[model samples]
Target: MDEMLSVRQLMKTYGKGCPACLDLTGPDHGRNMCPVCGTIVACADVSLDVYPGEVLGIVGESGSGKSTLVKTLYFDEEPTAGEFYLRSYEDGVPNLYDLSSRKKRWVRNHQMGMVYQNPHLGLRLDHSAGGNIAEKLLMAGNYHVGSIRERAVQLLEKTDIPITRMDDLPRYFSGGMQQRVQISKAMANNPPLLLLDEVTTGLDVSVQANVLDLIREIQRELGVSMIVVSHDFSVIRMLTNRTIVMKNGRIVEQGLTDQIMEDPQHAYTQLLINSLL
Candidate 1:
């Protein structure tokens, strides 16, 4: 499979005691949670590949660095030291963690997008649903604002959000609806990679099923490679071909979704699978 994003020997740290901190100036020392002292070293020396047209599910308990790993992959957090590559077009490649602020803005505008755990954290709560979706594109300089409302409406409809509510504030929407709005915002630029962090975290099982189905359908339509961070094995099985099991901030086992589910090698993996039974 072709690689869309690759992380090799990547390391990140925070705090004053890390080896990385010795080698380089630490992050603002006043802040205890710096990305330079091995704060998330559970991901140290980690390497993985996300392929085109595939969904890679990352499952782990909270505080295991699953969020941090996803963020770093998308350049949301800079690695203390390592080599990585994001396959962009003819330009050959781009180091996601090393782009200049100006260049990084370009990638953030179009090729990369994230669906956060908290919809409010990623959306403009003050804006209407359509405006929230269109705002991201406008920031990306997507000039067709004339048609953006139309585009936003299509997304609202596709995500099962009623077209009648396009002009409503996010605060007025239910949790599930707000999540759908986040999905629509993420797809605004038709990004190649989407980082879905517990996208269905707060929804009911009934609504989770619907939202997951919607995500799968959209990924198929867009040919987007998704890295979904969720602890739900059923969601992983339903949405991803491959599985990565994280524990204490590191990948303990990874393989085909079914294989890992049916015949896990690691004890922790077995525990996870058993919980489902």
Candidate 2:
């Protein structure tokens, strides 16, 4: 499979010029934050690739840079330094960071879909469910009301949300339903790249399973490339064929999910598996 997305030498840091911050540099830095300067290294030297139709998992504890990496890719956060390439964009040759802001926005609207951990971040609570999806479709230049409505209904039904409730605000729906609506909205444009960040967090186990199953179904049916970030091993194991384990702003290990599960080489990876056991 061709690489859908490639990231290299990605770094994100906060605070600058302090001696402590300057001193706190290197791949094996002890902490992500500078205790003396209070500078934070959210991510550093991260590199990875996601192939077309592949589900890539990023697993790590809180503050492990998993979320930061995805956020940068999604354009929700900017990286201090990096090279991002999306194959579908400019034939996957140009560095994304070099694109104009307007061009970047175009890429975000037409090529990538992001489902944030919080429904509020991804959905408009006050808008009707259909309206939320329509927003994305409109941003992508689909202006026909009938076509937008049809697309919204198709996505909602596929995500197990009733078409009857398309006019209802997501704020009125249950948490799981709201999440499903968000999923529907994210896929509103059928973007080539889908980003899921701690998507199943704060939901009940059964609800989480339903959402995960729905995600699996969507991925299988649509063949969209996805980057799923989470702290849970079960989520990663269930959804991704390849996994990257991160800790303290660095990638500790990466491999086929089964191999990582059966024979974790990194101490952090082993400790994570043992905790699960």
Candidate 3:
């Protein structure tokens, strides 16, 4: 099967870097900061492939760079070095990072969708629920007001948001409802790939279950490829077919979720699983 998304040697570093940055920082070195140059490596030499209809999970502790990897993929953060390819974009030939800003915006609006951990980042809380969805649609070049409204209704229904509350501002809704609205807006364009970053964090347990169920349902029904980043292993086990374990700005292990859960090869991965037990 063709990969829906491919990333190679993706690196994101903060501060002025030096030659020893890569050699001095990582799980092996027990840190991701270059003491010599005061550069922080957010992620380095990260690579992955997401096939059509696959849900790939990235799990790690705080500052593990899992979130940074996804943020770079969604274009919310720029990578210092990387090659990104999306099958829906020019048949995955040209590197997306090299594309012009206008073309990158087109790709972001038309070929991919992102649901941020913070609804504030994903939705314009000032806009009404339907209006937020319409904003995404507009960016994707859909202009018919009637059509936009109709699409919004469908998306809201799909995400389990009430059609009656279409005009309500997301800021006024409960946390769960706000996230639902963000999901609706993200899916408004029906993009081929979706990036979710710590999406269920900071929610009530029952509400988190409901939201996870909704996401699983959407993936099952739509067959949209997704990259889900979370520090929670249970979340990864529940929603992902494959998993990538990251540490100190580098991937330590990656494989089938079940296999990795049963037999983690890396010491860091084993430590993580033990914590869950």
Clashes of each: 7, 0, 0
TM-score of every candidate relative to the true structure = 0.89, 0.96, 0.99
Residues 1-277, candidate 3: write the lDDT tens digits.
Answer: 2898999999999999999999999999999999899899999999999999999999999999999999888888889999999999888999999998899999999998899899999999999999999999999999999999999999999988989999999999998999899889888999999889999999999999999999999999999999999999999999999999999999999999999999999999999998899
Q: Tens-digit lDDT track for model 2 on 90-109? A: 78999998888898899999
Candidate 1 structure quality by residue, lDDT tens digits, 3-31: 88777877666544554543332112322
Which ten contiguous residues of candidate 2 have the minimum total lDDT? 17-26
Consecutive 10-residue window with the lowest summed lDDT within model 3: 1-10
Best by lDDT: 3
> Which of 2 and 3 is ahead in lDDT?
3
Better of 1 and 2 by TM-score: 2
By TM-score, the candidates rank as 3, 2, 1
Q: If candidate 1 were superposed on the true structure by all CA atoms, what would the RMSD be? A: 4.9
lDDT of 2: 0.91
Distance from true location, Cα of 204 in model 1, Å: 1.1
User: For model 1, what is the C-alpha lDDT against the true structure?
Assistant: 0.79
TM-score of 2: 0.96
Q: Please tell me which model should have the higher TM-score, number 1 or number 3.
A: 3
